[model samples]
Target: MTTKLPTLPSLQIPFNQPFATGKEFDYIRQAISNGHLSGNGAFTKKCQAWLEAEIGCHKALITHSCTAALEMAALLADIQPGDEIIMPSYTFVSTANAFVLRGGIPVFVDIRPDTFNLDESQIEAAITPKTKAIVPVHYAGVGCEMERIMEIAENYNLFVIEDAAQGVMSTYNSRPLGSIGHLGAVSFHETKNVISGEGGALLINQPDLMERAEIIWEKGTNRSQFFRGQIDKYTWVDVGSSYLPSEINAAFLWAQLEAAETITRKRLALWKQYHQGLIELEKQGKIRCPIIPQHCHHNAHMYYIILPDLESRTTLIKKLKTNNINSVFHYVPLHSSPAGQKYGRVSGNLTVTDDLSSRLLRLPMYPSLMSEQIELIMNTISQFLSSQ
Candidate 1:
């Protein structure tokens, strides 16, 4: 007798899918009709205004990408050559690259195993006279310990620049993720919760940085003030670059911002379903689900599970892919990368960062991911672990 292999599902599911709120086309058409397709146009202003109102930032400037926003923040922070910026190794390269572009060095620290955020306890020891800032990336839309980070910054006279790329509509201790730091950057990339295909915004909390922030956003010119009638003419006044996105992207973003609440509610529901379904597996020590602190209200940007080791994670990922479900892994520790070795220094032991980066696997997460799809994914995961 021949053994029959388990049949795979014909339906395919990707790790992420860009969702539309149905108003994108109408807004884009309006932008086209307005005849001002340039940056800082009507649509751009609407997006910025909405960000300021909703996130309670003193000033908000939309940029072409989160990388652009972080670069702008680096400029505003006045990063000097050899200046060290403290951050986690378990983050996208942009978190360190922005500062490196300004001749700054990234000081890598360990992460809290719970939230996968910069461990606040390790921060003070990493501080040196050359330390210019502390960048707390809100990984997976979960906030870092901002209060303690802020207190440490105040004591050390360091800047706090938040890389809240996955933090749209998320909150930490009742404050919006991007609004608590001296400067914050949020992304609207296709992979993020709210997206404009390729878009981001810089939130300026301190009133003092707003002027220079605009100057940098406008390619080192006072063009914004000139348009506001605050200056006779615009001219290059400082170091900056072309960071603004065109009005078309902003138009699409405006629609997403309007429906941010509804989108978040649905995504949260899906996140809860995954969490509740995987409880038994987590308890059995077969996998570890994402941990959300009591103070955090995450935007459900991602749903990831930690396997026992790298081999198990790789095996499970292959199994899922064979079944037409695409699961993926998150960042490699920046400290272990080639560029990171060249441009950054390690502050403390990165045991957690290394272990988590290897074992973590992100499942399918998107607003339109049907409940049935979630069930299939969970059951597949459960069965695979059971056989292991």
Candidate 2:
């Protein structure tokens, strides 16, 4: 008798898929009819105004990308050569690169083992005279301990720039994630919950910084004030860049922004299902699910699990692939990367960051993901763990 192997299922699940709100085309057509495809046009103002009102920021400037927003932040914070910025090593390179562009030093800190956020406790010890800012990345749309971070910033007179790239529609202590810090940056990449293909926004919380932020968005010119009749003519009064996004991108973003609530609600529902389905595995020590603190109301931007070790994580990922599930891992620790080693210095041990980087695996997460797909993913994971 010949031994037989069970055929794998044909279902294919990708790591991420961009969600459409059904009005992107309509808005884009409207923008085209308006005859202003340039940056900071009518559609741009509409998006900016919506963000300012919704997030309660003093001013909001839409940018071409999150990287642009962070770079603008570095300029607004007046980051100079040799200045130091403290942030977790577990974040995307942009978190450090923005400040590095200004000749600033990145002081890499460890992350919290549970939330995978910058360790708030270690931030104070990392602070030095050269420390100019603290860039706390709100990983997976889960807010960091902003109150403590804010208190530390107040004590040291350091600027706090919330890297809220994944924190849109998420809140901390009843306040929006981006609005709590001195400045905040949000992403609209295709992978994010709300997307504009490649878009971002700079949220200026401090009233003093709003004027300059606008100037910086307009490429170092006071063109905004000139348009508002606040100046005789816009001129090169300060250093700035063309950080604004095209009206087309803003128009597409408007549709997503308007439907943000409904999309978030549906994603949250899927997140809950995954949590419920995997609770047994988490309890049995097979995997560890994401943790949300009592004060946090995450936007369900991602759903990830931490395996027991790197080898186990790799094995599980392979198993899922064999079953046609496209699971993926996240960032390598910045402190351990080549550029990070060259441009940044580690303040303390990054044990958690390194460990989590190897162990964490993000599952399929998107608003458009079907309920049947969610069930298939959960069942496949459960079966794999059970066999282990």
Candidate 3:
């Protein structure tokens, strides 16, 4: 599905605008001419092959959305009714819901105060007899401490599934974000750095799981192998769902992938502009800019500022809206939500998660965003802080 363009004055400065490469429409029209609008078509194969080459994964399967990819990961991980999945509470609901759908209990953990990522130090203590996997979400395209997280998972013989919905073209320790884990999920939703309106990919690193991953992606059928002449017929062979996206979505995404490097470069330039503009406010202790670790490289998926308190954040958002600038807050602590209380349990004190989530406010971030708009945003923030 395509995103609707801005209509109102306030929408002119929207929180997000779906980007497009010059070839998107051309490729989509080609997909129509190819006479195959179903999943796993030529366009879909090109997109998957691009992901495998770019991310350096053993296999890549395109799915309907990131949530679907995570669900497929859960199925491949063999999550049981009482298995426990450890993850940070400061994440999208799909991270937990994927496992929960398999009857796995989510073990909610706190995040690091700096990167807002799952703290590796806290992970070891959270392991138990039922612990099945460690799911580390790369918040804001910044890599988590994957080296340590991988060490912990290896020692415990547990699976590592990366929830890298915001981490395409981002790396940790010179390795791609999603490719570091046993199985990884990436989003191509409208809000992410690379978008297909509604699409995602499951990246397989373990050779053992590569074949099964394709089966799950094809609704538990061996259709992929059958087409390759590895088998004569295909039929349902496992517990899975229809996770693959349409050929149209894959066509649009292929255009984006061809220009992924250019897109990331533009985004990084915009991120630097935001960082430079907010330096004075940050130095004055009025706000906190996002922190990127020296060992990691991010795709500049988003840019946000942390206020001193929730009240300050609310006030700033209101002020921005008054000036036709749209600002928004991020996730609520999952442990505090009703669904979380019913289906998950806390691993430890979530002091950092609660504190950071409340004060964080996301600013306008998109490739097409103008420098003048950023200047106005920074000036408005400085003026508001000064008046206080």
Looking at model 1, residue 373 earns an lDDT score of 92
TM-score of each: 0.97, 0.96, 0.98
User: Where is the poorest 10-residue window by lDDT in model 2?
Assistant: 1-10
Candidate 3 residue runs with Cα over 4 Å from true position: 1-9
Give the C-alpha lDDT of model 1: 0.93
* Residues 37-156, model 1: lDDT tens digits: 989999899999999998899999999999999999999999999999999999999999999999999999999999999999999999999999999999999999999999999999
- The list of candidate 1 runs beyond 4 A from truth reads 1-11
For candidate 2, the TM-score is: 0.96
Model 2: per-residue Cα lDDT over 160-265, one tens digit each: 9999999999999989989999999999998899999999999999999998898888989999899899888778978888898988899989988988898899
Instruction: State which candidate, 1 or 2, has the greater lDDT.
Output: 1
List the pairs of residues colliding in candidate 2: none
Ranked by TM-score from best down, the candidates are 3, 1, 2
